[model samples]
Target chain A: MNNWFKILLLSGLSFFTLGKAQEKVTIGEKQNVFSKVLNENREIWIHLPKTYNDKEINPAKYPVIYLLDGEINFEYYTGLSDFIARTPYADIPECIVVGIKNTERTRDLTPTKSQKKSPVNPEVTLFADSGGGENFVKFLQEELKPFINKNYRTQDYSILVGHSFGGLFAINTFLMHPDYFNAYVANDPSLWWDNEVSITRTKEYLEKNKKFPAHKMLYVSQADNEEKQKNWNSDMTQAIEKFKGIVEKNGSLNYKHTFFPGEVHGTVSYPGNYEALKFIFKGFRTDIKQLAKNPGLLEEDYKQFSKKMGTEFFPSESYLNIVLKFMKSNDFKEPETYFMNLKNKLYPKVK
Target chain B: MNNWFKILLLSGLSFFTLGKAQEKVTIGEKQNVFSKVLNENREIWIHLPKTYNDKEINPAKYPVIYLLDGEINFEYYTGLSDFIARTPYADIPECIVVGIKNTERTRDLTPTKSQKKSPVNPEVTLFADSGGGENFVKFLQEELKPFINKNYRTQDYSILVGHSFGGLFAINTFLMHPDYFNAYVANDPSLWWDNEVSITRTKEYLEKNKKFPAHKMLYVSQADNEEKQKNWNSDMTQAIEKFKGIVEKNGSLNYKHTFFPGEVHGTVSYPGNYEALKFIFKGFRTDIKQLAKNPGLLEEDYKQFSKKMGTEFFPSESYLNIVLKFMKSNDFKEPETYFMNLKNKLYPKVK
Candidate 1:
């Protein structure tokens, strides 16, 4: 390490002559909606998918997912969603994500007030102003959903996502307001509040209702370590497990339960979120090879999906564009005429 | 859905007047370093860690990790690293990441040119210009490393990270230019390239050398389904498995291997990069409770790291600031006096 050489290394570095792509970075834009129900101004972070941005004209409208804990988990959820949408396997259709930020963590997310001790420590009591969940639900329905529906290009299909205390909020929303969203994803929710009052509510709901809505889905993940490894009893994991068994036994709702064996409560969210996304969109992948193999199968698949969704799923132009792309890249000859014929049939309505 | 209510949701759909902490999102800065070795300009994306921006004066110098495949994976790596560094359980020390963008990805990343067909399809041959990996390593050593080391507050302790062909590039650089980086992280490297040429080379090198340097660490991850579930034998996972077994058997070098089940090749990079970071920095998290238990332990831990890094890792001021923060947050009474005594001992050097 010669001093002069090190100094030379330190200075006069040359730059590129070629024009560089402009450095562009965006998480999402901040959106604030005044809530007449909660009587406060609320904030949300909204991220539209890349595919939506790709076509300036005739852009596709996407389903929306409302996420809780926006201030902390917004970046992670958006990043993961964007990645999943772009990837080939389990190709998630682009979805608009509205990440709702917290005004008060304990005040809003919890379904009930509790003077009970923290599950981990009996000495430390849970937050005092803890029963604002019903009001929060009112705010989302009356203020945010209507605003998003009026402003954005949306299919009116929706999902709700949350973690920890936020997860508790998600389950409460699902139980009380079932028609609000098509799916709910909860990760390691703190169900131990007020001696597992939320869990008890869940049990009562399951026992009363013979069947949940057929189209709606619920995904709940309990972290492996919190109860067993961290303590013996009375934790979030235990309450979640109890709720899971009851919900699973009811067998009426389209429910998924993921138990992450090696992951703890802290690290569980990342994998939990990823796994939950996969579970929610179980068949949401496009196999190019499989599509190329049988053109008729692709047509039938979308028809079946359309019937299930109660919306016409004639995605002719985009499907044609993809077919052309594959034809160029993979030298696929048969799919070109298949898409062209499909497009002709689909375009008559547009014409 | 009343017309007047819809108009209200739209009209009052304004942003928050409530003071937001400001949504801050940074991908990285665009950097172009002219490579005299390759006679071309190379572009890179560099993300400085949280600690770098924490202070205006006496900014902290971090160990840099140079990541290959910047254009695609840069955002993922930076996002994940930022998340891990901030989290409580796996509190990775602030690290500067330099993501190297590709001009000709196949040309630069592959060590040997392949005339053979794609592993999946024997009809279609692999890329023609693929033997430039040695020259690419030269460009990194002579040009990019010097530029990053010169411009940034870097400790000269470096890590090289890559995935797919980029992962192959990382392993080749490790085998050939071992002294260039302190650590290497490869995620499902395409070691199947040139009929497992890199794998053969890795095996040869291990056989020749009795022991690798103690300071260097290597982390390799392979997606579970690629070789076994997707196809058999002649896949990326097989080469990686072969290499992993050999490296782990030698047991002289610091090494880690992660097998991600049910994850395909395309998506493994996200969790793989995350798992690799956790493995590389095992027991790297800072626990306030652990620190409170023994006041002398933090000093000793940094001392050990410093010795291992061959540079003084007494992260003095930042470490102190965090300790003060924890003491305030957790109401630790003893660490206050502990910090005062430690400051008296360490601050004279700073003064």
Candidate 2:
């Protein structure tokens, strides 16, 4: 072969080698476009899982978890989600966690502006330009949703999780547009904002809106509060009680609230987010009673359930045992028999 | 002054300024020497907390969590521990985590060697050099422990956590020397090593050794074995059941076992470690039921108990709430009344 021909062949071989090398998951930066109600050039941080490219038979689609305060909480949430989703009891499906970067948190989160600076950081402006939450919601609904839907094989269900100001935004969004998300987690929301204006608003909204959708909401509070001495805890308690009381009066609204008494505002988000995720997507009935009745259903049947459920079901042996426990609880004659049945249905030749 | 003296003075000032600039938590390689047991030549990675240099009257001794696989898991664990500890639960005290580097995992982890190759990696030789677990434990007990104790203002309580082969080593150490650590978290231990030799050894140890100390042990496993079609699930379940049964029989042993059903052995460690830490150091509680009936005990009496308990007692508002839960469960009439009596005895101002 001529020199040029040889060079082309070599280059081709190099390209193939490089492609193979890049096959494994690369942990770094990726540019994402955001064109909601806001401006055009909004970039997002996307962390692709380890097995993003290698498998060829069937492409995997991840459940999307939209987190607010992308800049500050991205690494944390991503690391945590990556860690916990891979665990046993809280085996949430592997997800594409889209950390929505914050440009103006106050403007986007706050329903109404209160002329109050954060007590902790007096110099730092809290709400320079407030009451842009409606516009922000529009951005998420119109632009962001369409973009994500068009690009990724996203399931119908999505989770919105946030902290403090971001927490308020999540709650407000859930209240205003219930259909947008399947689950909502609010960590230590600024309930003290505008003398509980949002709480009052929540009460009014619940009263007017009779049809509450089937979903999950987790409210978390930290122990170290600046306003604790001045009844911040009682104020938050009263607000939550009032909200819960109203929901009770209406006799609807799927939600749970937890107080992280020993946790501070800054640190409560991680564990709260973790527990919230676990609570929301708590898997299908693995209880013994349900399984024992359907004795023929084998391991393969559950495996199929996992596959069908997609990213919502994090596959785990412990989870299977949990199902086994449920089965045994219902006086299932043989745990091994059920397992064998599952195995035969799922993979007859193997094992 | 002379011309040379003037130049030297200016140079000294410049050097001082340079020193100030470079003083902020210097990263990279450093040789740490603890005592005669540890060689000074060993490279150490030290991270001082944000408040390390703060000027405070009563500088607190931070709790330390020593981790295996320093090179890989250190940064992640350190960041996580710091973040969570700073949160509201204050479940475990804010700990300074120390990651111990490994030279050879197989050599360090294994207590005995068998001439066998890994089924997955038959081409590569396995278990060639093993039985270094004893020495590895000694290194921690003698060299590392003394050095850390001498250098840092560390609390008496310490945690030992490891994963994979390292996890096997951690369990081995815990089994051998329970007094060395307050808590032990082993994630995805290699139970299938040498045809379940470790499992056999554990069974033998439990049967023979009747006396078990008071410490926490958390073992975690994952779901990847099913994909490999190995008996990974059975192995995990058996180990868990056996361990739990042994602990239950002993009554003196405090242990918990969790299986991450779908999680791969490689990825289950992180979440398992976090959860294990939380589970282990839940809190310090004393049986106050006996004192409850004595109505004559003044509020000042409770203050004495608080004073005696010192750092172990709940100081933060949220922790107080948890204490209240404990109190209520023990049939205490009112948390305020109970706490008031305790506080007056232990802490006058707070009561």
Candidate 3:
């Protein structure tokens, strides 16, 4: 064999090993299943939270986040999950992330496709296959969700996150079928789809529905790049703003509209998703020392947050481990013993 | 024995193989060498730009970027390089990225050992044996740089990018050895080393040096997270602002200080590096269609930019390919022939 080829093979082996050698590993399981609705096989990447272990006797049931455009976006979101949910801070609650890779992105992410091309999109054939967004949502609802619930330890609450055309599908799904998810986050949604077909539906939905689903939230973000550029005409921002206005006019709708000024289409996902998740878990605090000092307050806070979020939201074993990690870092001594004993006393082992 | 463990092993294999399948990939060759200065085997990751092997006729010599804390951060920086240098827009010029992984982070990154502890750092014992930074710089100069130059196709121009303690090292190296790198980017540099030893040194250096090396730049960034929290005491930002003020007062120093308002110390590297590289390549344009229309102007621009950068710089072949890619996207016929013909006529292949 050629030297470069051998070196390449050896490096490839090292890359996989290096990925696993890290402590807070983000190794995801990829599974393929045939979808009856879609009439094709779909590959899904599912990342379980660090706390998840089937052997730990009724370990934990986590809320699921169904991330659209997950083929390319999973790695970044996985990093976010490792930091927010699994890291020492435990800044956000733990949840399983289900990243759904796509076969045809345009077919699945647009509500009603049109032949009309926006001046922003020069490629006329880009939106050729239209009107499959509703079916895609059905594929999620009727097929994917049931399979996940059947196989994994999942809670009742779930979140739907999307970007660009995926964002359009997320918002459209929320409007068309409001009870599908607990929260819907759309980042730089392609509202220009089908001549703003989804935006028109949003106004009509607001006029008729009078109130959105209980304990549900919707967030829409617009990249400021389009608005700043002279030729782009700011259509995406305008459509999103118009949607936000309609939601606000409804009075009972829980909605937020964000604008990332310096971010363009490609760069919006990083900050956009970070801010959206922050908005979702705005009240969760991570200072272990402060929380430890006021145990009663911490208890009350979790219970109240659980009630608000419609999930049993106590700190997971992994979360308590991080707290103990801080304690050990501060020279409190033998954090392993303290946390283990406390875990036994507070939440006894099933076996 | 467990099912999850078995699944994990399979996934690991899949991940590595998948990483291999991609063409013109950013597959870094990791090699180790015994450094006499450090008295240990040091690992370095060298990523050749996509265009390096595209055309075999003595392909381009790229500027090297030495990234500190490369073990974990290399993946992110690699993605950034792919986007900025290899992507369609080619927002930044293509260059080789050399990621330097650490053996003893504290020993090498800090300029001096300090007994004094900040109230924010709970672990007082974290900074022991912390005065090896100068030696590390020596190792880079004597061993690493010589090795890279001898082995790889690299320009004399180089950049040093570091975050946190590594940032401290970057600034120290720039102050002590101005000719080592053409640009220094310090993202949220921890300037509280040895009771502000480096900061004091920075003040004294600026007073004497009169002017920074021509065309060389230094950028410092402060994140908002440290400022918002009560316990953290906002020292990083304060120190950075003071340093920025000192450089500004020097007048002739090429300096820029940026603050990511909503970003924390950990989260700052992504946007910080992105913005810093943008600042470095602010004048390099990649719009190929407009450039193709006036080919003479594009050639002249590269020459002028090369002169300004104090290095021989030219748009890489991959950069040209992306231009033709845009042309192909916009209904321009036979992009390959035009680009090939243009490449032959304009930049004649080296014998």
Candidate 4:
């Protein structure tokens, strides 16, 4: 090839790269999973945490959060997870969020083949294609989990989060297959399904097991559905309260139930999810200021947190770097050295 | 071209288009604005609401939210706004979020030349490059706002949101240029800047005017900052409380102060921003069930809300569509016709 032609081609390629300079800010990627259990192709939205791609740190495994109602919640949920998982005062371990988009909302979420008269129109029925909740859970455990575990750098610990009918699915999955996920979150769940079948399941579980499982966490958020003002003792509100009463009485499961007074059924998930994460990872945040005086406290805190969680978690290189920067800037020389050693120990040099 | 060659070219073009199908879920776009006032280029992140590009609806105008700390807060804030503004249960109008990325943090956000000894290390001084707040606001007012208005379909209503130093800037901006935005949100603002200069400014304004602007709204959120346990009356806490007292005593501005019991400075903004939007658009939510019985109630509620806001806020076409769907499905023929007429009146068909 001519030297001038080669130079022109190289210049054109450089221009194309420059033109492709990212104009849109993206949060997650779309991955299609063919689910044999459901006999369908499902699209999953995957959002990796900030440190997942950081070259400065060694490759790390992250807890996976399986979120239901992907299209509605994925955008905010991903951003919120990253925001709360920021270093130095991290509230939770950085985790990958897998948002499962719904193809058959009623079919995949309802645990039983039950139909209800629509609130607006009694002639019209709701949840006609229900009873596939068990099937959906099977897909998650058998196909989706393996796909995520195979493809991503993931930790053993995982969380299942859902709202409304999705929330019902989370609780049912927890009751049926307790070992599948480490923690469960149900936000304004449709616990009133089939005359409160969830309450019956809870009672049965306690009767059979004598106590809820240890180390497994459940967080349920109940919304103050204003409809109760008009129809006193609405089934939706009553069912949740009954479940809360039963669970609290049992006192074996690590559980937290928050009732947001002003929040409606549609909006309770925002604050509920935040509180759920904090509850699930209760001891995750370590004081950066305290670290200046006592560097060893970092590991001690993590040790205590891990013991409570029944999972192993270590300080990320990114977090250690943040701690080191704080210590160095604040003139805590000994602490700075301690963190430097900690970072090296946790994330060894590649070469 | 030959018939075979034409078919082959068409097939290749279709293949290329299919290969370029969307893989990443995007929330916003990045736009760089040249600010002659500041003599620099500023990158702005812009997030449009869901219905912005819907072919089914006519082009509509939306309120814009000017968010500070663009890099840190833009992603979640946009998502939160969209979530809250979902049709049929919208707590606020759909909004366009414009997040201004920082160039020089301390230089642009602080109101005056200010310096403070670091809490961790007294040898280091903070805000050395301060006092450019006025200039930054000038750039926003003169350059950025014009660029946004010229480019996008915008409503007259706009909100200013900020956190920490950015929060300080929001409060200062509200006080100095009250008419610039309809609402202001300051999440855990650095009210203690320059030994509580914001407190002095608040007092001075109250004394001079005896009342704040009638329609403008301000929402301030104070974090619990667990450090308060160690130092009961820290300057950060004291300054914020003092400002709150002065403003509340004056009782002129549409103001709200929320003390988040467990939220720290770093994490308060997530919930704070959510509450701030709710506070600003308190009367925006209309009951779909109520509308089924009283079709005229929608317009009445909007009128009352508009009167309170001192701005005209018509029912959005998307919202009207949702209302129509509810009425149609519920067999409320009269209400369905009423909403269809309302939608047509508000947003006429282009043809």
> Each candidate's TM vs. the true structure?
0.87, 0.54, 0.81, 0.93
Candidate 1: C-alpha RMSD to true structure equals 5.7
Segments of candidate 4 deviating more than 4 angstroms: A1-22, A227-233, B1-22, B226-233
lDDT of 4 by residue, A262-319 (tens): 7988999999999999999999999888888788899999999999999988887788
Model 4: pairs clashing at backbone N, Cα or C within 3 Å: none
Which residue pairs in candidate 1 collide?
Answer: B163-B167
Strongest candidate by DockQ? 4
Docking class of 2: incorrect
* Predicted candidate 3 versus true structure: per-residue lDDT over A199-266, tens digit per residue: 78887876787677667888777777563354553677777777777778776866777887866666
lDDT of 1 by residue, B1-351 (tens): 443443355346542232234354555677555566776656677887766876532566787888888877776577677666664454567788888889988889989877666544467776877789999998888778777777788876788999888889999998998999988988888887777888788778877886777778888878865433464323777788888877888889888888887666777787888777777666555554567667778787777766765556654466676676666555667876887677656654445
| Deviation in Å, model 3, residue B2 alpha carbon | 27
Preferred candidate (DockQ higher): 2 or 3: 3
Candidate 4: what lDDT?
A: 0.86
| lDDT (Cα, tens digit) per residue for candidate 3, span B99-185 | 888899989888887655646354475566688999999988887888788777887888999999989999999988988899999
When summed lDDT is taken over every stretch of 10 residues in candidate 3 chain B, the lowest stretch is: B16-25
lDDT of 2 at B239: 55
The CAPRI-style docking tier of model 1 reads acceptable
Candidate 2's C-alpha runs over 4 A off are A1-36, A39-43, A87-90, A117-128, A150-153, A215-233, A248-251, A284-351, B1-79, B85-132, B135-159, B163-168, B174-272, B275-351
- Local accuracy of candidate 1 as per-residue lDDT tens digits, A1-351: 443433344234433222234354665776656666776656678787766666522556788989998866777677788777664443566678898989888888988877765443355565877899988888888778877777677886888998888889999899889888888998888887678888788777767887777778888887786533454323776788888888888888778888887666666777788887787665555556566667677677776765555455555355456665675566666776777677667654433
Instruction: Answer with 3 or 4, whichever has the higher TM-score.
Output: 4
Put down candidate 2 lDDT per residue, B52-80, tens digits, no spaces. Answer: 45453134466678788865565556556
